[model samples]
Target: MEIAGTLRTAREMGLVACTSCTRVWPAGTERCGRCGHRLHTRAPLALQRVWAWWLVGVIAYVPANLYPMLSTRTLVASQEATIIGGAVDLARHGNWGIALVILTASVAIPLGKFLAIAMLALGVRHGSALTGSRRQQLYQVVEYIGRWSMIDVFVVAILASLVQLGAVASVSPGPASLFFALSVIFTMLSAQSFDSRLIWDAEREGRRA
Candidate 1:
């Protein structure tokens, strides 16, 4: 059975299996509510369509770092903090816990997710058999952890709203907010664009006689 454009195969009959019930069903069935899956004969957009979004996310990640993410004003003095600066400020204030949180959520996680997606995209594009399962595992990790990267964004928004003062102090989001948001959004799109079925397909092809 097929759902979301993926095909499932039956072990015994060696034919496409119903995604919902695990029973063998003839092709072109409109619905299979038993297993709650759809049957589709054709594969979705080929691998390239998936890779394109990954490529865009990789490109956007660069600028997301170079720009300042937040601006602060206190006593008529203004300062801006890039992603690294925010982490440094937390460290300076002896807020090690928040510092580490910011570092992992903003820096390490985003980079890791991007690299993982890039590796997955590259492996699929070149049909690389080198540790396909590992690549797939990396893809799953990226997809699952993608939402955590929003922690920094939420922190920024919350602080900006809470620290507003007529003249004594204020906080505002900066250009990096847009870039950082785009970074998260595109990376998520990158993860979603990947086809996990390709990993299984490659594995099955390897075992085929």
Candidate 2:
């Protein structure tokens, strides 16, 4: 009954897990043998760093949406297209499927990452309706899918590189390309800064309260 009366976390049990190598070690071990990353039960000042990066991500994302993502120069004239504008043009040209893909990758994924990171950060501070396991799963999903958000950047790069014809026609990345890349980078850093142990800690605290 005593054993069943309470649960213990990895930290409470004197275990620390390595983030890089996923190796488990007894607490107080200085580094992981497999990966050499310093062992700690939870990341120090996790929320502060998460918020800082998140703020950067949000700021960069604003410009990513407002500015032109790509510019095209032809024998006739020059044209610039924002992310939404590019998608709309694609749709107008009867490429609805590709437009939808672009919209989902560029807009939906970035916003989803921001919301998921914010929710995880907030959930640690205040209890959430989502179970700890569920939120952890969300965190993993956000982390895994983060790199794909750069699809728009890749598209722009490919177009710019392939379309250059030395006065005939050319495509070039716009200012938004840099901002979009930065937004994705910062958001990914924000997500990585989070300490997943805090999710279970919150759950335990809620149970106790």
TM-score of each prediction = 0.78, 0.91
lDDT tens string, model 2, 1-209? 46623667667777888888878898988899998998878888999999999999999999999999999999999999999999999999999999999999999999999999999999999779999999999999999999999888999999999999989999999999999999999999999899888998988888889
- The residue pairs that clash in candidate 2, if any, are none
The top-ranked prediction according to TM-score is: 2
- In candidate 1, what are the lDDT values of residues 1-209, reduced to their tens digit? 33633444443233455644756556656566567576543235635655677667667777767888889999958999999898899899999998898889988998888677766766765666567678777777888999888878888899889999869999998888777877788778767756676676666666674
- Candidate 2 structure lDDT: 0.93
lDDT score of residue 163 within candidate 2 = 98
- Model 2 scores a TM of 0.91
Off by over 4 Å in 1: 1-43, 125-133
TM-score of 1: 0.78
Query: After superposition, which runs of candidate 2 have C-alpha atoms over 4 Å from their true positions?
Result: 1-7
State residue 102's C-alpha deviation in candidate 1, in Å. Answer: 1.3
Best by lDDT: 2
